[model samples]
Target: MSTVGAQSRGVLRAACRQVGLPDEGAQPIRIAGNAIWRLPGGIVARIGRPDGREIAERELAVARWLTDSGVRTVRPAIADGPVLVDGRPVTFWDELAPHRPGTAADVARLLKQMHQLTPPASLTLPPLEPLTKPTRRIAEAGLLTTDDRRWLQDHVGQLAADFAGLPAGLPAGLPLCALHGDAWDGNVAVDADGTAYLLDLENTCYGPPEWDLVSTAVKHLTTATVTAAAYEDFCSTYGMDVTSWPGYPVLAGIRELRMVTFALQIADEHPHARAEAQHRVDCLRGRKGPRPWTWTAVP
Candidate 1:
């Protein structure tokens, strides 16, 4: 196991003990941003960063809200919201059964449903703040040089200004609603019966619907992770091609910046990701030609 995995496992064990769950058979699902473990008894545990208490709490609330709102999403486990173990927030979820990664169509349909629902007055979902994660990563990413850091900070500032000055409410003519913050195929799980369940509620918030569509557009146009055909299906299912909007470039740029900064953040902890992170920074700095530059997933 990597250092992150080992340390997170230790945290998971402690968290399980506190929550009265058996940790002996816990298996790692993913170890980036958050450490996800498949615990015994059909429950999965998500262990977040040291300061992630609020995020965990919000995620649990979102899951319940979605469930109550008639959206088919992953449900929280029987335990309480989140328990702090050595500063890390740990939340448990019921594991999905016999699932595969959701298709582009699945992402689009689910996001459409999510975008139409009105959040209850009590929920108080935060307005979308795109700069929070990337700016924080750029500051914490020790692997970046002084020049690189300055350039990224300037780029982020420009994007933020552009985003704030959009001619209309975000994307120029759409009503805002609750958004699945990181809407993508990876965040949706499809079960045996082809039912889609939304996962990773950490980024759920109130925002323009276009923000949710940008991820698929970036995958298809910028990174080539999603094929053109799949992207067409996504746009058709969602009933809007976000890339066609006038404000798309700005949102796309912001998403690309977030991706690059995330790579840098991962490189700081994993030596193997250093070269890829530097490559991403180079691509962003115009050393690489243009869009469609390939980016390998890190961690």
Candidate 2:
């Protein structure tokens, strides 16, 4: 297997030339450990190994779709319709400015706007949204225990019950917004002036707009109470009635499960990040504290 570093060098070299940026053999500004590069010209290029084609395609489509709704992301155009770069699939990005700190408000407002835009159902069908079984990916990708898998099946099985008591008439059917699917902090960039832009949107899926809230919340839960609070502040600013989104808490359950699945996959390479994923999973499983959703004993 070609190392990510080797494949990234190839992509950046070609992408720099393609995008009219200096190719002086673009130096690797950052490596993704897997599937990415932060290269020269402030470009963020995503690499697709043969095995990672689905990831490449999903990111391409999702980022393209989300870009239309005015979400700041590195818009991807095909590099020769899936040609090989150093024997790996390659996609180039338009450089985006950095994301600055103290811009939680910007983050909140942009996220709110993106969430309010509905995803086209056709996005799920084909040519636009190629469906990959994420559960299967998480499972096969080696990120969950036999116990974790079974637990997820059981917990997600109760999703209907999960949303049972949300107040009715609260933000029901507000358009399903375009999501970053993978909204972790590392994938965000702040420009010199403090503008926030999203990167690596390979997991975009259409669902209740509430899904974006869960994505935005989970990472911050571990690190930033103030950022978390500021996120809540966005709801009112965006003209969203706070009570309207009944699915936030429940959707969090599913999102947490996925986070576990990711953690398991990277336990070896990213032990700390994996541990955090496990902790969040434990919290949601009610293993650490109140499983907030239970509200009462599981009937």
Candidate 3:
């Protein structure tokens, strides 16, 4: 096991002990960024990094808010605790039963529903800060050469400016509301009966609906991760095609940059991610030319 994996398991064990849940037979769900384990009794425990307590608390609150608003999301298993275990924050969720990744249309409909609701006055969601994580990752990436790091930072600065000064912000008729922040087919799960539920509320925030739509647009337009037909279905269901909007290139650029930096952030801890991280950086540096770059999905 990688160092991160071992450390996460230790934290997971400590957390499970605190919650009176058994650590035996706990299956790892994912081990990057956050360590997720499917525990016994239909519970999913997500163990975040040491400094992630605030974010974990926010995630719990966001889940509660979404559920209260009648949005079908992964509900919090324990309402009061983002239990701190050995400094790592752990949050428990009610695991879904036999679900597959949601289709693009499912993502669209769910996002549309989320974007329309007014967050209750008590829920104080932070405004979207698109460049925060990517910029930090780029600066901290040990694998990048000096030149590569400089170039990526410069590119991030330019995109940040473009996003702030967007000529026609927020699209035509949409008002800002709580966005799924990382909206995409992958972040949604569809159950056996085809009911879709949103997952990963850590990034949920008050933001432009366009920010939420841009991920789907990039999946089709830039990375081609989703099929053209699926992209069409998403737009038809959501009532807007984000790629057609004038401000799209800027948001798409930001999204792609985030993907690249995210890969870099994990490359050191998980060596298997290094080559794909390099590939993504190369694509951005114009080695691979333009849009529709063949970017692989990394866990």
Candidate 3 per-residue lDDT over residues 42-95, each given as its tens digit: 999999877888889889988998888889999999888699987789999999
- The per-model lDDT (C-alpha) reads 0.89, 0.54, 0.89
Residue 143 lDDT in candidate 1: 86
Error of 3 at 195 (Å): 0.5
Q: Rank the candidates by TM-score, best first.
A: 3, 1, 2
lDDT of 2 by residue, 97-151 (tens): 5444334455556666666666666565122121123355445644456786677
**Highest-scoring model, TM-score:** 3
Better of 1 and 2 by TM-score: 1
**2 against 3, candidate with superior TM-score:** 3
- Give lDDT tens digits, candidate 1, residues 55-79: 8898999899889988899898954
Off by over 4 Å in 3: none
What overall lDDT, based on C-alpha atoms, would model 2 receive against the true structure? 0.54
lDDT at 181, model 3: 95
Model 2 worst lDDT window (10 residues)? 290-299
Candidate 2: stretches off by over 4 Å:
1-34, 40-42, 49-71, 77-82, 85-88, 101-103, 115-134, 141-149, 160-170, 183-188, 219-228, 241-244, 268-281, 290-299
